[model samples]
Target: MKHIFKFLGIATLACLTWSCADIDKDEVGDESKLPNAVYIEGADVNPVTKLTVDAAGGKSSFTARAANKLGSNVTLKFAINEKALEKYNELNGTHYKLLPAKYYSLSAENLTISANNISNGSIDVNVKPLDNELDASTKYAIPVSIASAEGGSLLNSSVTKIFAIDRVLYTSSLRQNGFYLKTTFNPPYTNLQEWTLSYAIKLDQNKDNQAVLSPDFYSRVTADGGLQMKVGETDDPKAFAKTKLQPGKWYYIAWVYNRQHVKCYINGTLDTEFDVPKVETFTKLNMSWGAFVGYVREIRLYDKALSAFQVMDNLYIETPENPNLLFYAPLDKNTGIKDVSKNHHAIKVYTAGSDDATEYNQSLITWQDEKFPE
Candidate 1:
């Protein structure tokens, strides 16, 4: 909800310095008149912000700023306004539980807004909800307020910055059993001359041409065993990455097809690249048969070939807003086949005895306790 900040606090101080006066009811907003008015910079834009914080615990920051130049140094005091959460849940039509005080910390409750130089300072909020006793399934909220500015006024309207947080712990990997994930490719993507496909995996064992990228592993061989990427029509001249993958370890694999060069990346480093005859192939990714065993996460498909730096950077992120991205999935077992991509698709999860893609069955998928390594 958008609200114009109306500050009226420390009436004695306000009367002595500059009496708190709100903007006109018709909204003739003039910040020059109230030079000492204070408001949180990030919260000023949107008082309530939603965040999906890692259950491992981390810090969230916000900047305390003034509506205008501070005549003198202003000491802004922040407080954990627990009462605000009540009104927040009432308005949003949500039954979010109040985040326990022990789960979070306002490390920077007092910030100094220097009149000479810096007009703002950071407010660090450290949260570790899962560290204590709590329901992982329930949603929580933390409301932090600019309680009182020693040299500035406090706004009753935009006092608190509410954080609607959902603590999510992703599954380490989803074992690709008998099922395979498939999506109908658009004309532009399948026909692209250059493309990049990346994902994380852990191999259980290896067989000759074990299904990795596609069900139809093509007529290519990298000696005894390894993963494969399709590059041409059935039985046509093919390209192979030929990287030696060890079993029982996690790997961030990237298959980049840049014109005549086919590159394969392992754990963000170039494992192998070979010059191949000009060839094109259809989209076949994350294909797993009953015989082949492994796990996968963050499977992404891009239209253009990605650089080494881009591949390395891609390892740490999920569902990035890239125009070249055709499809992406963090493979969070909780989400269950939901693609968090530019063109997101609720791809069907094919099980052993289930032929229908439309029929969704959560019990068929198993979620591992471990999560992606950094």
Candidate 2:
């Protein structure tokens, strides 16, 4: 009798396992389970985002549900305008294509089946020679679309973000005459956020042999001495050290000072800070990444103070390959400058040849200033 009972238990367990396996397979076939609610009615498709450089890369992802209440798998299609495609496909194209700029169309083969456009999916993408006007201030439309194969119905369509590429500085080097931050008097403003400087700084090193790059550098070298803050002596020029600023590493220099406190960030991390002066007035702030020459790409300025989180997110595009710590590896030994501005503006500088140290304006965010005036 004991042997018979063991056999019956084994049989029951087998039945349960088979039943569960069968249900799992059915879920993939049913599209009703997918959640999406969107419909594309017109021929005009909204662009997802605009890119600045001739070679650009980015990712786009969103959720969608089927049209009818019935769950049925739908197909998605992402395509650029024919003109954009033809331009990229040109022979011996003078333009170069780079990652995050490569075009691609992905489909799950009826992956979504649900009531309305109800499903979740995402795709990573890139584009080259993005059919944008040569002007940096002008905005261009990048058309994107989604659709189902069965009924051939189109879904979501909307413009993404505007893109701005800074005016290009075709020269070989920037002027060495560094700009001073006048923080003490007018103090740098949030409007200074997008401005970037890429030249190397010559340190007048101290006993420690370490050259210091301070947060107040923006205000210290400025016409006004330093900005007003709550603590510490703003006049302490030694607030910085004589540390080596290495080449091939990317650093973000900001004119970051306000009524609360004065600070500077390196690669999205806080490297220096100073107390707010009691007088509440200072200037002559100075800052730099590399001195006299190096490389700078994607310089931008914003009108507001960016929180740490916001700055990190914006800087992520160029954060890969430890770029913030070191330079990006390129096909040639020369370093590659990734995107500087992520949201609406950016600067990208790539070295075409070796030997000449690339220099840019440390004071001007826009390319309108003379980098290396003839």
Candidate 3:
């Protein structure tokens, strides 16, 4: 279970979509046989309450229901309670901020659970993250509760339901042996003055000393025991240590190299900037992989140095149709690695050992399909 406990709170009634006077109590039930209780939908069966709103925004709804069917109609009023979320954060030791009212509005304000319907109308939470735009890095949530009830009673402490919000752009990724897969550039990997590479990943394990992303001859390790990103030469930049890359969280990282300057952006924001002594313009840009534990569906390589704005904009496009893109791999499709760019580089898995008559045998690597990125 992603969550085990929930908080209970009382909030002021929110704006209602319809009046309770208009809703008729239609159904008939035997008072002795029916369970006389009112609660939020799905309160009995604990569910991970997470809602991810894309730039296009999203819509989700939950209703108030009567356990079984009450003998008469029970009208319930719901509202958003920020304190409940604060209490939840205190209990869970998390720092999730309250979603602003402008980005979201409730539609399930007044629901009447009548004899005809066990579960009545819903409170629709519509979120327009892109309208004003939400900070992609911080966690946000909404705590909803039945503010008031008429002719009914609340059930078993099921008052408030908290919904965590996410703004993940990468909805698809995979782990495959093709992880070690590579393809030689048509023009080859030399004399590159400016370049840009972007990757979206969700760390799967906390084990350190493992290389999670190897775009070419350059790769980053789970250095400092899976908390830091190793830069320069293979996993040696101790100075670049930072407590980033937490497991089970998604991150969109991009590296831009121009002349001797290097910049790293995490989740569309610039995180690292430094000057290096002529970075690797790999002529023989290839690799043999080890154990890499993460999900990656968005991998891009461009010949030109992309600014922070460009890197931020790139996160929204699934398959960008651009002339400068040298290699683009969505990695969400099935069977065989595919480059969706104009180059359409032929991916080939190479043998790292002595290339004799193929004697040493090692199981091949391939990527497996995963859930659409959350």
The runs of at least 3 residues in candidate 3 whose Cα sits more than 4 Å from the true structure, single-residue gaps closed, are 1-171, 177-179, 215-217, 225-243, 284-288, 316-318, 334-336, 350-373
Q: For model 3, how does the per-residue alpha-carbon lDDT over 1-374 read when each residue is reduced to its tens digit?
A: 11111111111111133433432331122234334567777855642266767767877777777665677777888888787778766664455678888888887578787765678667778888554365443567878888888888787467778776756543335553323555567556666788887777766665655554554435554544333334445443542424367777777777788885777787888877766556545533333353556666677788888866457645634334566788877765442357878877776544434332232222444455443344
- The ten-residue window of minimal lDDT in model 2 covers 325-334
Q: TM-score for each prediction?
A: 0.50, 0.36, 0.48
* lDDT for 331 (candidate 3): 62
Which is the leading candidate under lDDT?
A: 1
Better of 2 and 3 by lDDT: 3
TM for candidate 3 is: 0.48
Candidate lDDT scores, in order, read 0.63, 0.33, 0.61
lDDT of 2 by residue, 135-253 (tens): 22222233333433453344333212112222122222122223211112133332232222222222232122221122333322221212111124344654442233443343444
lDDT of model 2 at residue 258?
A: 51
- Report RMSD for candidate 2: 15.6
Q: Is candidate 1 or candidate 3 better by TM-score?
A: 1
Residue pairs in steric clash, candidate 1?
172-370, 172-371
- Which residue segments of model 1 deviate by more than 4 Å? 1-170, 186-191, 215-225, 233-242, 279-286, 352-362
Residues 42-117, candidate 1: write the lDDT tens digits.
6646776655567567667777776666767888888877777777656644445678888788877788888743
